[model samples]
Target: MRAVIADGKGGPEVLKVVDLPVPKPGPGQLLIKVRAAGVNRADVMQRQGLYDPPDGNAVLGLEVSGEVAGHGPGVTAPPIGTKVVALVASGGYSEYVAAPAGQVAPAPEGVDLVDAGGIIEVAATVWSNVFMIGQLQKGQSFLLHGGASGIGTMALQLARVAGARIATTVGSDSKVKIARALGADLVINYREEAFEEVLADHGFVPDLILDVVGAAYLRRNVEILGVGGRLVVIGLQGGQLGEMPIGNLLYKQGSVHATSLRARTLEEKRSIVRATTDALWPLLASGTVRPVIAHRHRLAEVSEAHRAIEDPEHIGKELLVVH
Candidate 1:
């Protein structure tokens, strides 16, 4: 099997296509012939040596969609030949990835396998952080950072459909229009505008904030949170540390939560995936939740895929067709 392997840690230059032995499933795992793999910020981080994959796994894809080529002990739900999307601990950037059965779920019936692969991680993160941790409700307002991103676009639409009002912050002016197209009620251009001021200008004190840029927005986010609000941090694109006002957080009755799907325990990720498949699949099946795949790359052009994602001009999910 051909896989994009990383040499030590560096930039996209570190990624190289090399032939490797096809991985086999261990206990309670499934050997999937990967059709598509989702490239994420974590993959870039892993490539740059900021984050490392777990023991015995050097590959770095958090989500995949493919066919079950084989299975191991105790695996039963998704039988052979079942088209499915799955979350894996690592190694999804290869032609074959062995995933634990617990972390895999049947893909939406009508979704193309190539596109279906890109949906798992985005949907998993959204379901867990927004609806579960944030406790977003109808008529309540939620603020999302990076509103035009693959996860951002999906999050905005899901939040609106789930009955919550949505607002988003973007780095570009064009993305504001794109954000609105996807259902965000207010789009603040953070390049030339202060998100805190813009939201307050509109009388929007968000009850929940789904933030991707963590440390950079910390103080402002804390300032914009209404009483008893929850701020969930999904990414640390903006530096990872900052001096925050603990007194204000206590006085304002707010909580800060940081979550990552990749490093979660197996059972935890499984439950998240199962819930996503159960609640989110029907929406995709009925066209209520549509995937926003922006670009697809051949298995060998993984370097280019990384470049495009980092370029900021490429919006939506970037997919690698491995099989």
Candidate 2:
């Protein structure tokens, strides 16, 4: 099988497609014949030598839409040739990938199979962090960073369906419009306005915040939390280290959690995938919510896909079509 990997940790230029043995499914795993794969910031980080894949798997992709080709020992239910989307630990940027069975879900009805590649990762991440862990409820104010991003776009739509008042930060006016259209009640251009101040003016004390900008936003995120608020940090695009405002956090009875989907145990990922599918799949199928795709590149153009994901003007998900 052909797979993409970083020849050395550096820029997008370092990415290369090479021939590799097709991965065999392990216990309770499914062998998916990849159709398309979602390109993500983590893949960029991995190529830059910042984030390392769990268990030493080196291929650079987090999610895929494909057909089941075979099953590992003890796996049978989905059956061979079932169309599916899966959240994977790694190796998604390949013609074939072995994913734990629990992380695989039937592609949502009415969604194009190629575009479905982008859905599961963001859905699972938002469902696990924003809904499951933060417990965002109807009528609560929710703040999300990176409103035009793959995760941000999905979070906005899902939060809207959950009946939460949404506030989001984006860098461009164009993205602000997109965010608003996607159901964010408040959209702040962080490049021009301070999100904390804008939300304050709106009297928006967030009950939950889904943040991708880690250290840079930590202090401000805590300062603006409502009583008993929860802030879930899922990415560190800004930086990794930050000082926690313990005093303010304690006063508000707020909690801070830093999480990553890639490194989670198999069972944890399985549980998240299941919950996401059950809660969000119907909305997706009915078009109440949808995946936002910015661009698609053929598998051989993987470098260009990475470049697109890193572009400031990029919005939503970028996909690598493999078949």
Candidate 3:
């Protein structure tokens, strides 16, 4: 099988395609013949030597959609040849991947199998953080940074369906339209004005904030939260270190949480998968929510896919077709 591997730690140019032995599934795992893989920001971080792959895995992908070719001991139900999408810790940028059985879900009924790869990561992340951890209730307001991103786009639709008023920040004017189309009730152009001021003017103080920028927005995020608000930090595209405004947090009775889906235990991930599928799969099947794919590339063009992700003009998810 052919897979992508980093030649060294650097830029997109470091990615290389090579032939390797196909991976075998471990206990309670499924062997998938990969059809498409979702390229995530974490993959870029791994290529730059910032985020390391879990333990023995060196391949650079976190989610994939493919057909089940075989199963390991004690695995069944998603029978061989069943089309499924899986959330994996790594090793998805290949023609074959081994995923834990519990982390795999049947591809949404109406979705194209190739595009389903983009659904797993964003779905699990938003459902777990915003709904499960952040505890955003219906009718509460939610704000998301990077409104045009894959996670942001998915979160917007999910929050809208759940009856939450949604707001988001985007980098440019064009992205404002994109975010609104995805169901954000309010969209702030971060380049033109401060998001905090915009929300203040509109009398919208978010009850839940899903943030990817860390230190860059820390103080401002706290300032804009409503009383008893929850801020969930899932990524650190900006620098990691920041001073906590304990006074503001205490005054507003707010809470801050930082989490990463990749570094969790298998059982924890399985639980997230189960919860997400139960809540969001119906929305997907009914076309109430959709995968927003910005670009697609063949597996050999992994470098180009990475470049597309880094490009400021790109919106939503970039996919790599494995076969």
Candidate 4:
């Protein structure tokens, strides 16, 4: 099998394709013949040596769409040859990957199997952080940063379907249109305007905020929250250190949570995957939620894929087709 390996992590130039022995499934795992793999910000981080995979895993990828080739002990359902998409800890940038069986879900009906690779990570993250951990509910207001991002795009549609008033922050004017077309009730160009002020001007304060910028937006995120608001931080692209104003947070009764899907225990990831499959699949099948892929590249062109992800003009996901 061919897989991508980073040579001493630095930039996209460090990624190289290499032939390796196919990985075997472990207990309760499935050997998936990868058809497509989602290229993500985390993948870039890993390539740059900023993020490390779980122990023993070195390849770079977090989600994939493929067909089940075989199963390990105690695994049964996603029978061999069944088309599926899975959330994986690592090793997805290959022709074959071993995925935990419990984290694999049948490809959504009406979705192209190749495109489904882009859905698993965003779906699981949004379902877990925004809906489950953030406690966003119908009739509430939700704000998500990076409206044009893979996770942001998915979160926008899911929040709309949940009957929440959705607001998002994008980096450019063109992205404002894209975000609005995806069901955002309000879209702010963070480059020109303050998102908190925009929300306030619209007579809304978000009950939940899904943030990727982390520390850079923390103070304003707290100020813009409605009473009892929850801010879930899933990415720290804006640097990690920041001062928290406990008094303001206490006054608003706000909560702050930081989480990462990749570092989670297998069982925890499985649970999130199960919930996402149940809650998000129907929406995807019905076209109420859709995969937003910005670009696709051959698996061997991983450097190009990584470049596209870092390009501000790129919206949504970049997929690496393996087969």
Candidate 5:
């Protein structure tokens, strides 16, 4: 199998395509003939040596869409030949990827495997941190940091379907329109204005925050975090270091919950998978929520694809065709 293997510590150049042995599934696992995979920020971070893969593993992708080719011993749930998409904690950047059965979900009735590439990880991440951890309730307002990002777009749609009022901070007017089209009630251009001011103008001091910008949002995020608000920090696109006001958090009763997807346990991931399939799948199948793919590239040109994502101008999802 050809896989994107990263050298221990280096830049994107180290994520070269190389011939490697196809990995097999162990007990309670299943093997997928990869159709396509979502290229994530974490994958880029891994390539740049900021994030490390699971011990002894060097392949980079964490989510993929494909068909179930075979099941490991004792596995019975998604039978062979089932068109599915899977969330992996590691090693999804290849022709075949293996994951525990619980992480695999049948692709929503009519969703193509290629398009399914963008769902698994983002859905789980949003559901776990934003919905569950932050306890984002229906009728409350939630704000996302990157309105046009794959994660941000998905979070917006999901939160909308969950009956929450949605707002997102985007880069351009174009994205402001896109975010509105995706059901966001408000879109703030963080480049030209203060996001906290925009939120205040709209009377939207958020009840919950699903942030992609980490330390960069640290101060202003607290300003917008309503009394009793829950802040779920999921990404560090902004610089990772900063000092936040403890006094504000204490006075406002704001709670912070930060998480990293790749470092979680398989059981914890499976829990997220089950929750998404149960609560979110119907929305997906009904087209109430959709995976927004900005561009798709062949597996061989992954380096070029990575470049596009890091360019500061790319929008939506960056996908890699693996089959």
Candidate 6:
């Protein structure tokens, strides 16, 4: 089988596709014949030597849409040849991958199978952080950073369906309009204005914020939180370290949480998968929310896919056709 790996770590140039023995599933795992895989920021970070796979595997993808070619010991239900999408700890950028059965779900009805490759990771992340952890409720205000991003786009749509008052920050004016069209009640072009100030001026105090910018916006995020607000930090594209505004947090009775889906345990991931499938599949089936694909590249063009993900103008998910 062919798989993508970072030869060393520096840039997208380091990524190379090489031949590798196909993996057989272990107990409770499913052997997935990869069709397409999602290209994520974490994959870029891994290539740049910033992030390491939890399982110490060098393969560079996190999610794939494929078929259950076979099952491992103790796994049976999904059955052979079932079309599915899976969230894996590593090794998604390959012709085949072994994923824990619990982390796999039937591809949503009505979505193209290849496009479904990009759906699971973002859906699981948003469901776990925004809905399950942040507990965003109907009528509450929600704010998301990187409005045009894969995670941002998913968060916006889910929050909209949840009946929340949605706000988002994007890098360009065109993305601002796209965010608005995606049901965001407020969209700020961060290149032109500070999101905190714009949101405040609009009197939109978010009860919940899904942030990817990390340290760059921490203080401002806290300052703008509504009473008893929850802020979940899931990415650190800006930087890793930041000073917490203890006084402001105390005054507003706010809470801050930082989490990463890639670092979570299999049990936790399984639970997230179950919840995400149950809550999001119907929405996807009905076209209430969808995976936004900004670019699709063949497996051999992995370097180009990585570069596309790092482009600021890129909106939505990047996918690698593996089949």
Candidate 4 on 95-212: residue-level lDDT in tens? 9999988889898997998899899998899999998899889999999999899998899888888899998999998899999999999999999998787888899888999999
| CA lDDT of each prediction against the hidden true structure | 0.87, 0.93, 0.92, 0.91, 0.85, 0.93
lDDT: worst 10-residue window of model 2: 51-60
lDDT of 3 by residue, 188-286 (tens): 999899999999999999999999999899988998889999999999987899877899999999999999999999999999999999999898889
What are the TM-scores, per candidate, against the unseen true structure? 0.97, 0.99, 0.98, 0.98, 0.96, 0.99
Task: Residues 252-320, candidate 2: write the lDDT tens digits.
Answer: 999999898988888899899999999998998899998999998999999899899898988999999
How does candidate 6 score on lDDT?
0.93
Colliding pairs, model 1: none
Between prediction 2 and prediction 4, the one with superior lDDT is 2
TM-score, model 2 to reference: 0.99
Model 4 bad stretches (over 4 Å): none
Give candidate 4's root-mean-square deviation (CA, Å): 0.9
In model 3, the number of clashes is 0
lDDT of 6 at 126: 95
Model 6: residues >4 Å from true position, as ranges? none
lDDT for position 315 in model 4: 91
Candidate number that wins on lDDT, 5 or 6: 6
Please give the clash total of every predicted structure, in order.
0, 0, 0, 0, 0, 0
